[model samples]
Target: MLRFDDLQLFVRTAETGSLSAAARLLEISPAVASAALKRLEVQLDVRLFARSTRSLRLTAQGELFLEYARLALQNLEDGRQLLAGSKAGISGLLQLSAPSDFGRNTLLPWLDEFQQAHPQLHLRLLLGDRVSDLFREPVDIALRYGAPEDSSLVALPVAASNRRVLCAAPEYLARHGQPQSLSDLARHNCLLYMLGGRVHERWRFFDGKRELSQSVSGDRLSDDADVVRRWAVAGVGLVYKSWLDVAGDVRAGRLKVLLPEWRGEPTPLNLICAHRAQLSTPVNLLREFVQARCAELLAHAPWNA
Candidate 1:
């Protein structure tokens, strides 16, 4: 005899850590959420939460009930989706996040095509270099580069890209002379990308059967990939950049690839989502579209030559 609405309110409150936050997600008044919890507790004849002036903590009984509630709601949602099946066209607001450069250069064009295909779906994209917190943010999906550390979330590997190529403008290479070996890199000005707390100044190369790592220095450093690309094109310094970002420039003769024989291991691109049994039709559609595009890009990577 538990109400579905009451159960939803309770689950939202537990997930959000407060009734006020749950109300905001549900688009209801806090008082209404509080009343629903009160009624649910009364009906169950159990104290669900131990409330203090500052915070609300779930009781032992509440914790046990929450697990069941989460599973039941997920099952119900799955059932609804199953019933809808492929007949259900994507139609809902989807929030997404991705790294700035890749999102603009890669995802933006594909998204335009996707929106045209699914006119009913509304999409909101947030672009930044920093990773987004899926639990705290109202995001449906996130596109992440490299590997993900969170084992709790579901990650789908969509595409693969190479680490970076050390390159420079023809004029710069002509004046400075191209580095013939890893040891020679020390003689040339190197542009570095800062990752985490470490500056990625070490260049790794594959020489037929062996791998080499060399430490290099530069007068310029940046966390932004686009800025690094511009600097390299302006003949400021040699830059290490993703093949996808620099491929067009290299093809157009604006930039030249320094080491054609030596290449690094491929980096992975992933589509991440919250670990849940039920995902909306709209989210699934977008994920599929992205996966398809990723495959296309991987097949035609400029560095494959």
Candidate 2:
């Protein structure tokens, strides 16, 4: 018979790509973990991993088994928690990743409120412009700006109504004059956000049934999105950014929305995870909370008027 511990070890090893690392995480000796895996393989009559000196990879059978194993373990854990009254409370370290600008400007306060409500729950947040690989990273979840392009991810829609908006400071327009049309944007200085070594200078928009992407240029670019927004506020250049990221600036009269008749491309927000099994009670609660907050913010947005 296969032990439950063996199932856990197998999953962790597959996730971490090393048995020793999984053993350390489980607080067990590597030898014991090795024996447990051997026992499991003997019972199942299938090799779960193909091991090399420097790496370990799941076999085809192991890949298939891993999905079921994760589902089984999650179900068992859910049942245990419910029986133990742990389901009534949210307590655990939730490792999360998010884009830097939204994480700092928007999510920080929301996270504080969440923490206040669930004091027992701990959070480890990583902020970056790059997408986090959930299978490889130690993150339980990630807040992404766009839809999950990878089919392997399970994306829960948090802000479907979110869209990008093009804006420039009044000072910039005063000095450079306002762009009269889409063609006019090319003549203006555009601020750019850099991601993965590429400057996102191609601005997309929707005019009625037609979609358009214009190649924009700027005198300055930064990997940090907040810096790009700051540059736009200082009248340095025009910027295309998420409405949520610039809503406050727009309201404060620091930035004025341009091309109001034309719509910027939609960039819906998603709460993404590796597996649906990872959506425990607290995760689900957080998802709902974020979705509601985003809706509230958009509802009161000055640009919406």
Candidate 3:
């Protein structure tokens, strides 16, 4: 078996073509470099170098071993760096995009805690309602609702059980009356949000064998989803939004879930990346952290009752 230091000395000696030169490069004495090469040759039972008074040269055996030696050293280096990174704690830039509402209210504070845990990590966040192009945009990851339409992208689920919820503030419910059934939504004002230049006017509900779908129109629409949530909280209109986005508001009694029996569409939250390779240690830790938060929110949801 080859010892690690011996292998390294052999490769350096072969590259430099002189034992003294390799020794100086490696910050070791020439005598030590000479002894290491001799020990290696004895182990292999092959004279790896031809020495003359004028010059040192590799024997035929040495030439063949050099390639394998270089590969082994490189692989060893890669493993060392990987272990070092793990030991050093997560460090480096984590650039991610998230929806306007969730980013502002939920992810922002969560990331603050995450950054505190790994102070070496630098975070760059972009918040919006528009779907960022992972390939075209300068974002390493994106937090999005619903599974990606592209089969090529890797969608790491943060909350598979999360769904859209139809909600309104107490004031709105008081003034317009709570919708008792799907048909009643037609008479009440619905707050709409737009993405990719089109308004999401369609609200869907699935209860047992019945699927109630409606094309809702409201007195207001906004390109920013957070603004739509704000409108709902202000009792401007009813809003259909992700449970995660509205969980805090519902918990605070700022919004009330309408039509609890008529379950809204499944809009599972996911961490989107261009591919599986994009899942680095920091990204994975972030996913685990966010997933835990989602689970906590779900556990307290009144709709579960």
**What's the CA error at residue 10 for candidate 1, in Å?**
6.1
For each candidate in the order shown, give its overall lDDT on alpha carbons.
0.76, 0.86, 0.84
Q: Over the stretch 41-104, how does candidate 3's per-residue lDDT look in tens digits? A: 9999999999999898889999888768766765665454477667347776677999999999
Residues 7-86 of candidate 1 have per-residue lDDT tens digits of: 98887777666888888877999899999999999998999889988898788999888768766776776566566556
Best by lDDT: 2
* CA RMSD, predictions in order: 4.1, 3.1, 14.0
For 1-305, candidate 2 gives per-residue lDDT tens digits of 66789998998888788899999978999999999998898999999999889888999999999889878877886675566565337776677898888899888899999989888778989998888878766677999988776898999899887888889999999999998888888998999888666889889888778998899897998998988998999999999998888888888899998988788888788999989888977788889888998998788653466
* Candidate 1 off by > 4 Å: 1-26, 33-88, 161-163, 169-177, 224-227, 230-235, 248-255, 276-281
Clashing pairs in 2: none
Deviating ranges (above 4 Å) for candidate 2? 20-43, 84-88, 170-174, 194-199, 207-209, 222-227, 233-235, 252-254
Which portions of model 3 show Cα errors greater than 4 Å?
1-81, 85-88
Residue 88: error of model 1 in Å? 7.3
